[model samples]
Target: MIKEFREALKRFLVEICEFVQERDISFPQRPSGKYQVEVRDGIPSIQPIGIKPKPDLRALDTLMVGLRAWEKETFGNIMEIITRSERLSQAFLTSATGDLISGNRTMVFPKIRPIIEAYFAETNSFDFQQETFNRICDKVEEELRRLPYCSKILQCPVVGIHVSPNCSDCCLQLESDLQVRSLSLEEIEEFLEYPPFLPSFFTTVVEMKKDMEIFKQQLCFPEKDKKRIECVVIALRLLFGDRIFVPFQIERGQGILGKVLLGEQQSYSLEQRVVPPPRLLHIVDQEKYTELKELYHCISETLLERDRAKIAFSDNRSKQRVELALRKWSEGLDQVSAEWKLIAHWIALEGLFSPSSRQELSFRLALRGAIFMEEKEVYQKLKMSYEMRSRIVHGDYSPDDPQLTEIALTTEEILRRILRKILQQPRNYMPDQLEEKLLETLTK
Candidate 1:
């Protein structure tokens, strides 16, 4: 397989070199326009006045055809092996190829043109191309061998957290594999270079560039390993009692020409208007960092057990109910509105506590939850929150109502506690066992 791949790579490089030679001969000689860099409010943008003759793309088309044939004949088998080992879908390679050919900001061929041009500067020797091809093959083989063991690192922009400056790297190592670290100078400079367009004339590009500094810290984790990390984020929100979240993430270590690949920004409802600003950045010292790590483990362990249960009993009703409840909880975290969040949380609670029927839902929910938690006040709190839930759903409550905020917070805490308890010993909280425990409590 390696020998075949090396041969194909050599052929591809030879074709690329020939195409470059041919394209340069056919290139237009006359200058069509002068390009200038214009700085507006401290943002530099290229301004081109006249139309330049288009480069002959026929050579590029021929090279692409050869590349496609190589992919089908040789790379396809290697990709299959990788897919099986990585548990990636069939579309993974296709998506990667699409990104290489038609990425928004950069394309692979154009970016590599400079390096190729430098290689052929002195002489277009076949021996030099062969040396280049051999060097590339060596690197490609090494990469293929390491690919399965390697994982993509995703740097998610985290709001409402900062690392203490006294720390060595300004990073908090949450786990061996996960960390909260300040963005590197390269990443910050990249942000400044490509500032988002102003939403209005009122917001200047310079002001937007200043706002980019708000992203001081990021949550770093393996892209494919986000399940536990996601639980950790939720745990952080629960611990801080604030809207600490990841708005967007960028995949690192896959840059072309010093430009990193940008991930999609999360869409928000109209009510959100804009991504919520950082409230108060909490500096994470050692003690607080330890606390954060421990809470993350607690939450992640529960989720891990739930996943195990699902795998063990794929069609188990109890497992299915727990899955639904967990989904609702995650959806609640995604919601920007307190009302929607409260509703989503209540639905999750229903999946956990009221799996069978909605008969006497309020009473059963409050009683079962309170007894399970071993707190009498929980019963009253849940009962009141259930009433508020009814009012919100019925469209009788005002969004500005002070009780809305209070109930949202209270219900979130209650639900978080309940989930943690149930997840700690999922078998004990299965529907039948839970009902038995509630009956025993009532009898007592």
Candidate 2:
């Protein structure tokens, strides 16, 4: 295997040198000679008097520059792939060179065939055996995680996917069993930002939980360890997608965020003990698994887009556009309600109707889906909520208004249901396209 790998490396190096040589020869020589000016219909055009090879074209320095660029690009690609798995098990990383080398003939070459073909813009020019390639990779994959970091085995991420069906909460759990290994302290700290925890994040408490551990063999786990574990769980949820319900010590506030899983039909909780339940995996019904896969993908994409939108709004340039107003609308979409902010959500949801006027907004929003359209009462309620929005925008309504709470609740629920349905569309849509779809639904 080592010998084969060395030969492949040699071949790669030779090809790289050959590519440079070819490029050096192919560098079209610049048109030579002093410029001669001519007048063409009162416009002056400059032309080269003689065409000759570029004097510096074959210089040693020129060759060196091209070779350096080639090396950087080729080697940079390999390093980029390596960097992606920096948090992977040390054993797997350390063995990467060996694996790549051994698989050079069978695995690496076969896997890279598509890339080579694409670069050449020809597919069948390269012959890669399907069965042989699959077998080679399967073997390596099996051996890849054999020596995972034992002390910290990452478990698959579990997500409580936010769902609303028939205008009711229909949230379900989606557990994807996958794991990652040790990252640097800085990296782990960065991960803590994902959970609902404020000031400090879940993964950030991991070390504190470890310090609380007692017993020689680390048998006795502290009571507070559950929160720390939940922090990791929550971070997993963020890295993946979906709501994660991690039990926190009573001292920590709010078990759920924004009423997530507030009225779940089947809530699963793990006991806080040294040895809790072996696992609480959420298995989708075989019949519904296909839909769950698509739903999960939708949820993941929407959350990612939301994060990007948040980051964009943070930029001062974005704030100067009409988007500044839209940003306010989006803020209320996911933001935890505050006394002063309640009315904003009411106005925000109304704008999703892509209204030509205040009057048309309610009808358009209602027409968006059966959740509101089919429920005539829901449609009326939505219209009423928009009227409340008018009061706030017109300075007639206050957060302290007695009816504000009910109106706020109605708007928030509608926003969640409507947004969830929009996200679940078979294909992804940007905000404008989504608005178009809302109108298209009414016509259809």
Candidate 3:
């Protein structure tokens, strides 16, 4: 029965933590009760009172009296009750027992004895002791389990080494979101200190509270409104030790599509004349137009080499040789600032941006404008191909907005088409190719 009592006492301590955790309360910082501690034959019993004054010693005294009566009605005098219900104060004393037999002295093993033997001597009866002892032990164990565990460290065995769940839930959520496959122990430790997951667990709780405020406004009627909100509140309470008040603010959704469309409007109205001018043809005079015309012809004639080679005209004009010289002379005109302006003005005046309508929402409109204004439909198709390339340069239009996705995809297609055209012999083999061919001819 004594053995059973000892085991019960140990379990009693363990149960304190369990009880405290269930109630979401903590154990007192210091020991309490007149029986601040207690002891059995060779073991100690400790009772924790969380941040409270000593418990009623009257209850402990009643228990000790009952224990004493049980001992007296059973094994009697050897049992002494210190009267303190606090388990940790139960101090056990062990002493060596000596025996003398047949004129010889021998030392026996240490025998545990009550340090207060005088108090135990007053007890008298000897009966069925073990049962009585068990009764007293059961009472003590019950009382001990009602107390809180003195330290969080003691609760470690019950819950794993993880920090409070409230604190860890955010990272746990983020990891799941980012599809982080696995994190080594070292990675977890580092993440505990870094952004997106860093800061004390309490900080996360406060942040979650703030998020809740935002959600309250954004999700006016969430599916599990109360439960979801309460979960966040409770998590915050556990994560951060704070009295929190969260505020809600609406987020604005202004985007590139809207901006670009407005820009197109402004462009046609010439409202943003102060902003940088669009990168398009800007030619003004007839001379510049003529120069641009000749340059385009020179460039196109050189590209029509296969057709030129097939034709056998023994004319003294030597059109091929003359055209070659014209192409070289036109190349200089292509670089002239005046010709570039003509092309720019022609593009701007092409009615791509309807004066009465909003500006284009995307670079596609810009590309389409350049295409329409160019002299040839072939040039229009060639310029149209580059829309996607320009769109990519613009980057993502807006956060959490899918409108740009279709535009981006279309832009990509235009770029691919333009790239294919650029790779064609005419667009691909440029003046650079001509210069190399001419150099070869001169060397020959």
Candidate 4:
């Protein structure tokens, strides 16, 4: 494999040099008197006497085509090994070499011009070229063999929560790679800035004069360790109520600021705009933080257990039901409208109860949920919210209706409580078993 790789590298170097030399020869040189003033019908206009020709990249295109063919045939295994190395991956990302090899020709010529020049500077000797190619191959092999001890830091801003000054150093280690901790003021300021641009004269600097104003607390994890962290965020929402959320933007959707400034009904395409950063509204003490960590652990463990069961029993209905409920729960929290949020939560409840038929689904959901939570009053709340859900779905309810807020809140609370109880004891609360348990409760 090493011998083959070295031979391939030498051939690539030779072709790259030839391509660069051809490009240099064909590249256009500046012409004197390139522009001239011409008069047409008593009107004077500036016109170009000689137009600058665009660079012909046919040689580069051919080189890349051949390189891609070589990569497809003989470079797959070596690339896999290189990309898998954390140190190598970081190096590639920083150096833009990854972009270069992936057929991004924009920066390829500039990047390799110096190296090609150095190779040419030598006395037209094959030995020097071979030595340089050997060094390149050896460096790549050394990097691949070296043990990766470097770790990647991924920090996500936590909205609506602050770490208490008393526990500034308290890092909630939720998993081997995931944790919640407070960052320094400097670090928090990094996220608060607007995306870079040339500012207009109208742009004014507004200072945040208050102490500890910005959200400094963040969910930190190692690279690729963010799996199921969204579920953990859902768990936190359940624990802390709806006072918090991590804000996210849809790439293909209209910017929120654009919609607000322009009327909501007005359609426009504005991909970039400054928006308010999500704020920290609540302070979390050590005790509450501990509870949050425990809840996160419980939810994460339940998900892992369900995943394992899903693999073992391919047709595991219980696993499917639980996952569906969790997804709906997460979706509900993501909604911007109160009506949609209520409907999403209700759908999650339906997923949990799995009513035998659509007939009397409200009653069944209420009964099953109330029974699961050992709270009789929960049934009345569930029934009323389900009725409101029906009204909203049928277009009978107005968006301006004052009761929508209260009902949405009530429905979300009920769903959160039911989900919490189910996640707390996953084994005993399987959908089928929970129905049987509710029947047993009714008999008693």
- Cα-based lDDT at residue 410, candidate 3: 36
lDDT of 4 by residue, 1-444 (tens): 566544543444455445334333222123332323233443323233465223233433432232334332223222222223344223222321233233332232333222232322222244533554355445444433332222223344555566666764645555565666665666455434422322121111111111110011112232223444554566667776653544331111112111111111211122243323323355667887777776766666455553322122223565567667776776676676789989888888887886667777788888778877888898898888889999989999899888888988788777877776665666667554656886786799
Give the Cα-based TM-score of candidate 2 against the true structure. 0.31
Clashes of 4: 1
Q: Superposing every Cα of model 1 onto the true structure, what RMSD results?
A: 15.1
What are the runs in model 3 whose C-alpha is more than 4 Å off? 1-61, 68-129, 145-444
Question: Arrange candidates by lDDT, highest first: which order?
Answer: 1, 4, 2, 3
In terms of lDDT, which candidate is stronger, 2 or 3?
A: 2
Q: Write the per-residue lDDT of candidate 3 for residues 1-444, one digit (tens) a residue.
A: 445546433343334334333444321232432212233443333333333242333433533555554353322222212322123112111111221221111111011112122122222321224555345445544553443221100000000112222332323231111100123465445334423321112111111111111001121223332223222322222222122211211111112111111111110001111222112222113343233233323333333332333223234233343333322222222222323222222232222222233454333334333342332343344343234333334662233344333433332233323322222322222321333444565699
Q: Which 10-residue span in candidate 2 carries the lowest summed lDDT?
A: 255-264
Better of 1 and 3 by TM-score: 1
Query: How does each model score on TM-score?
Result: 0.56, 0.31, 0.18, 0.55
Q: Tens digits of per-residue lDDT for model 1 on 1-444?
A: 556644443444454445334333222222564333233443323333476334333433432233334332223322222223221111122233343223443333233332233222212233434544355344445433432221234455566666666765677666665677766666556543433332211100000000111111222333336565566666666566555665444444332322211222322111223434445666667777676766666555455554323223223676666666665775676666889988998998787778467688898888778877889899999999999888989998899998888888788778877765655555566554556876786799
Residue 286 accuracy (lDDT) in model 3: 38
Could you say which candidate leads in TM-score?
A: 1
lDDT of 4 at 7: 53
lDDT agreement with native, every candidate: 0.52, 0.35, 0.28, 0.50
